[model samples]
Target: MSAVASWPVVLSHGPVTLRPWRLTDRGAWDEIRRRNASWTGPWDSTRPHDSPEPPLTFAGMVRQFNRRARHGGMLPFAVDYRGPGERRGVLAGQLTISGITHGSAGWAQAGYWVDQRWAGRGIIPVALALASDYCFFTLRLHRMEVAIRPENARSLRVVEKLGFRYEGVRQRYMHVDGDWRDHAMFALHVEEVGPGLLARLEDQP
Candidate 1:
């Protein structure tokens, strides 16, 4: 049986629901990859370099999702809308806990991507808000960090809209496109978590 065989893992506001990635999601996931190929190619690390195509099978995605789920270090979920029958959105994201240390710096890094079509729909902010809350409250984590390419203005806005503070810059932090690129570090601590996040979408114009 799969780790997420049990239903309804985590709940959040909006039609957006975070649940275990299902095998049925393969088709939609592939469509998303295909649609966003050009938009996501530069920043997405999972995109294969050799093949100008999406993964041949969902088995690879299933294996990757299941491994992270069981590993406990990371919990990956398929972002969908709660409608008539689990209608999936164009966006998918995950929360990763790494280098977990006790007392202080018990932090996890968060990374996410959205279908370009859903870019300005405020989906990413809500997802980030809920995920951050889970990290601070449910996971009992001290901090959550997001490392983004300095050139990614949209991503910077997402983190900033959520009230994350700019920490510093890491040179050659992440490999984007092909070469290692500099990244701007942003973080939010447990104490910083509050009701303010609930109003994030409302603040959007």
Candidate 2:
């Protein structure tokens, strides 16, 4: 586990925050999933029709993420944006540091989704940069990876902007929508960030 036991409770940079999932987040999760259905469905992973567990349910999701965190194999976070809000934070989507491996590998993979309404606002890249920095600094991890389907231009743009070096293509990487999909992999080591990803973004106009 990371040195910080309270990891993922909340981490912020500018208007973006990556925090742990909460049971009370059910309403927002349901609403956003409904609104972003067509926008996000194509990229989302799917289970076979005969699968026993439901594809997604808020309570089940909360329990699943909490368990991963407890065993130190994952750090699942809900991404939020605070943009001129009247008060509380609003859920934009989610980001997860899953399949975390320690010891020799020291590796982890990041996965995320942003509400369609928030697209083109640079939320995913900034949030990812934040998460990666936390993993490198707080967790002392060696490598972080983000894999995106070849056709997902929006997501591809994110890693491009963040300067994640392209690795290669993975054939039939995972089940997406209703069939297997290929993905392009990108990765960055801790030493590459220099001053940090958030800092780099801030230096831009």
Candidate 3:
């Protein structure tokens, strides 16, 4: 019963848009990462010292994302925001739906990061809601989860605003900032957001 979309899918709401990452995005992505290195490093995932996975270049990363997307394993989106009077959107961040499982499992997890310049503007929540609705309705996934470092208060608020329930914590769950770090798990089921996640977000005061 697994459902996956064709590659290069795009989702949008108001000023925010989620689209496939492009090779041309290398420059902007690199610049943002450079400026925000200190801002995002503490919570960002890091390869374990003992692991054999090679580091990925920007092009390599985009290629891998596209390959996984074609295989229905992941949705790697480059977040864009089109502000007033701008002819085009600018890359503002990234949101990825990874670890998708079908059949009885029917679940997936989402992870995201925004440029420091875009933080505190509610863009991540919009991007998250768009992605979650796509999973719940279009992909027919049963559950969606977000794992956050307990210290990431900003990320915690995004899930709270969307009404995802706090499930529990996973100790030493993932390698982050050079070591295995604990994560507080939060989740939402399709039944819980009956209308749709995006709709729920819009209805929020």
lDDT of 1 by residue, 1-205 (tens): 2222222356567776666677877778888888888988877754436657666367776677666556556656666644435664433543333443435556778887777766776677777777666656666777888999888888888998888999999998876787778889999888776654656556667
Q: Rank the candidates by lDDT, best first.
A: 3, 2, 1
| lDDT by candidate, in order shown | 0.69, 0.85, 0.93
Task: Tell me which residue pairs clash in candidate 2.
Answer: none
Off by over 4 Å in 3: none
Candidate 3 per-residue C-alpha lDDT over 152-184 given as tens digits, one digit per residue, 9 for 90 to 100: 998999999999999999999999999999999
TM-scores for every predicted model: 0.79, 0.92, 0.97
Largest lDDT belongs to which candidate?
Answer: 3
Which is the leading candidate under TM-score? 3
How do all the candidates rank in terms of TM-score, highest first? 3, 2, 1
Return the lDDT, model 1, position 132: 69
Residue 103 CA displacement from its true place in model 3, Å: 0.4
Deviation of model 1 at 160, angstroms = 1.2
Better of 1 and 3 by lDDT: 3
Lowest-scoring 10 consecutive residues by lDDT in candidate 2?
1-10
